[model samples]
Target: MNFFGTIFSYIRETYVDRLSYFPSNIKISLMIILFCAIAIVELYIYIIFRRVIKANQNKQTKYWKERIGNMLASVVVYDESENTAEIAVHFYDKLKKLPLKNSTVNQILTSEIITYHKNFTGKIPEVLALLYAKLKLDKRSKKKIDSKHWETKIEGIREANEMGISEMAEEIIKYTDDENGLLRMEAQAAYLKLSNKDPFHFLDRAQERILDWHQLVLFEIITKNKKLTIPSFSKWLRSPNDTVVMFCLKLIDHFMQFDAAEEVQRLLKHHNTRIVKKSIEIIGKLELEELEKHMFEIYFDHTDEIKLEILNSLGKISSGKYADFLSSRIHSNDSKIKRAALYAIKRDADHGEARLLEIYHHTSPENQALITHVLDNRIKQ
Candidate 1:
């Protein structure tokens, strides 16, 4: 108190007393500058204090990670035996004896166990799952899932999915169509990972448009998990949602679900050009020779984009029946359509190159150059 009093008295005598002689404006300016300086000083102290606290937290987290990692390592490597339940119980007893009651400690423990679970398989994962339930980390995850914040819900869903908390599948499935796109994506992924019965049940009921990137993420998840039963995407082909139909087409193409070929053939006449174009492309890739006539029927009435896809598909089909149809389009006004036609003609193995040579001299110089480019072995379109 005496030190503070001395400092206050010195400031009063040194500046405040001198400021009284200055004009009112000058006094106000000086006061403003003094307050600004004090604020800057306080801000600097606050920043330094926060840094110290963060550094302390990082140090503590590192220590706990190492300790928990070592303990989990013992559980995984030293206890690989037939009696996994007994081993899990022993590990749970060991963990309870530690300082895991603290939330911070529990978080670290959860993270470390999840990391282990991801890196191992077989009985190891089963043991970790048991230990997770024993430690009540699932309850923590459940609380986060039920939180009002979307970010917290995502974190909870991710933790539960990663930890293989199968019981949380029902809770996570509720968010599959969340208004928040990211939360919906996470919940859908969790449902895929956790749900054993009808894992893709969300697709049949999804009302919202699944974004393109979200589709890619879901596709990757489905393809990578071999255990996941690949459903016949054809069932969704008749969906009212165009995006769902588009995604189902892609899946059918990838999985080579020839069973869906009939449904795909029916879509060639659909009003949506995007869907029609994809249907044509898939039919070509699948080499459904029967649909070639349908593609030819729809070729002239559609836009240049659809024409280009049809031409490309014909090239992939490489059936000699469309050689004349492909050759006729070589004179199309649209340069893209013309090139697509030339490529298709060259790709048609039955007398396609001969057809190109036959038209080379009769066509315009630009058409001749396109034909030459298509025929050139060095350029791989």
Candidate 2:
């Protein structure tokens, strides 16, 4: 045993001596320096990510505040436009249909975050009109923006020369900031093709930072003024921020854009399940049956928020193919989702009454009242 112990000690010492030759002190110092450098890089990356996220969030918040103010004003205007007491009631109904799920301020913020930066045209008119609509509306005394990009806009204003194309340019400049979406789109059409065709030319350079402009411009180009809105809007649906995609779904209100169904399907592969569920829900909002398959998938997800959204949307729209999935969610362990399922079934459907009644009698009093509300709505319908 002693001999074996001596041999082991000798081997250990030999290993230690070999290790010592590696300059242990220098190695330790190098390791410490490397660790610190890695830590610094990690910290720098964190700070950058935080700053970007904060900036994005801040912009959204600002837009939200602007939207709430505009919506409130629009609501008031709508009330006065109506000659009767029903104006207030109609205005409330319209407000209810709006995509806003939170306070008007927060809803605007949420929409802005998902809203394309290039699409500022939609919101720009909101800001400009509000600024001029009422003195009470003017909060910022900031400098007014130049209506024209530069002297080209001024020179184009020489319609007396009969320069037809130049006159068109002038028309665009004049209405680029107009409250009307059609006019704004006309302005975008006057420039987009020509600008991209000869990108290096001065005419294109005039709108060099166009992509950075508020998405009101993009939306005008993509939606109201023309047919260009879908592909661009579809691109945004797969964006990193789910909020951006959410608003994209909201803006895409037309039936033709509903053909972009496949793009929304691509969103099911999104890393965030909330975003995936929202994409499907938006399809559901558009009354598209294609969203049913994804609805089934989202219904099975463990997330409460995603499940609730699916339940709500599926209950409203999923009729033929996705009904079974919606039925299964009624049996979900989650009381909220189950209650929502019962409510949706009761309102838009009658087949689920037996299941709903089973829960109505068996579930708690609060749940029973909710189920009763659904049944009452069904009776009224």
Best-matching candidate per TM-score: 1
Worst 10 residues of 2 by lDDT: 136-145
Residues 177-285 of candidate 1 have per-residue lDDT tens digits of 7878999899988899899888888788777787899999988998899989999999999888787898889889899999998899899989889899999999989
Q: lDDT tens string, model 2, 1-381?
A: 699999878756645555466578866865686689789999999999999999987887777577655765564344243433354344445444544444444335323322322233434323323322232111111111123343333322221111122223433454444444443433444443223332112122222222224445444544554423224357555555454565466565443477668888777667767567667667667766666666676455547887776676666673745545555554566778766677556544546677567666766677677677767754542
**TM-score of every candidate:** 0.80, 0.39
Question: Of the candidates shown, which would achieve the greatest lDDT relative to the real structure?
Answer: 1
User: For residue 28, what is the lDDT in candidate 1?
Assistant: 86
lDDT of 2: 0.51
Clashing residue pairs found in predicted model 1: none
lDDT for every model? 0.88, 0.51
